[model samples]
Target: MLKPSTLNNKLRVLLIEDDTIEVMKLKRAIAKLEMPHEIVEAKNGEEALDILRNRDSLPDLILLDLNMPRINGLEFLKILKNDEVMRFLPVVILTTSSNRKDMLECYKEGVAGYILKPLKYDDYVEKISTTLNYWSSNELIKG
Candidate 1:
């Protein structure tokens, strides 16, 4: 467990994923990194839109899963990019799909980055840790 005194800045990350197990894995990975980040979750794109619209402050970044129950990641990306307030927000796709079509589409829709999930836990942790580190070091626009 991380002591509050030792913790640094908490970067808010909106995680839009439908699978409960995948969400848990991601949480574990972030925790292992000890990155001092906060995660807000949504099961699907519609839910994510609602959360974004209702909240006063926006997150530093969004971690999106392409294969979701409703409105999927691509649709979510489109909606987010179209919105005036959320258009500038960074969105990174974390997904199992490695399809070239999907990758091109996400880039077309304005995703900041696209990450393919590794099958192994250790690899996943490593990937997540690196991503967190990079984002933490970079400056994000104030919401």
Candidate 2:
């Protein structure tokens, strides 16, 4: 498990999701962790791209959902991974998609990790906590 002390700086997370309930669940899971991480949200990949383009800085990590109204996760991943500036930013797939193709594609495109959102609340919390712990302990490309 990763200790908060292991990470001297607060994590900056960008959540790209379209479902309101799922977003709430993710926020709840994050709150349960009690880590001092900052989260920014985008409803879809298009909005996420716009946010990335307009912002002067990028988030340390990006939590992406596979399904959305515009510019689905795979497409977004392609765009992000191809960019010289954004390619270094770590991206994690946090979606319910269990597609083998999706999994393979994300890995090929350079996702830090691929996590399927659990059906139960406790399971969800555990998954989120473990993921954060691992990422928090490991050194990122940004470092």
Candidate 3:
């Protein structure tokens, strides 16, 4: 169950990750942090795209993973950036890849942020908490 937003600003986050463990970790982190944001999960980029295309109300932010089967994160980002409506949606890359090239490409494609998954669980939780807090405070465009 999700807690009520104490900050009076809740966010709907679309998490595009292929690893089940990673997905569970994020959920656990949110719960531990006592954040009231809603999480919408997608196993991969393709699934995420489908969800985005069919949803009535779009998510406030997208937490994307770079490596996945089918359409990779970069490919998905390209497609999303080309879309008229979805292009404005903030996409934050959350992945283990620290490749400078990948980072540059993501920035070139206009990602809101790029975060490396920390080795320590505590560090991961901290990063997630900080990222969510920042986005929650931002004035997001409601589609």
Q: Pick the candidate with the highest TM-score.
A: 3
**Candidate 3: misplaced stretches above 4 Å?**
1-5, 141-143
Tell me the tens digit of each residue's lDDT in model 2 across 48-74: 998899557698889999998879999
Least accurate stretch of 10 residues (summed lDDT) in model 2? 1-10
lDDT of 2 at 3: 36
Give the winner by lDDT: 3
TM-score of each: 0.90, 0.90, 0.93
Residues 7-124 of candidate 3: C-alpha lDDT, one tens digit per residue: 5478889999999999999999998988888999999888998999965768999999999999999999999999999999999999999999999999999999999999999999
Better of 2 and 3 by TM-score: 3
Rate residue 105 of model 1 by lDDT: 99
Clashing pairs in 3: none
**Deviation in angstroms for 27 in model 2?**
1.1
Error of 1 at 75 (Å): 0.6
Itemize residue pairs with steric clashes in candidate 1: none
lDDT of each structure?
0.85, 0.85, 0.90
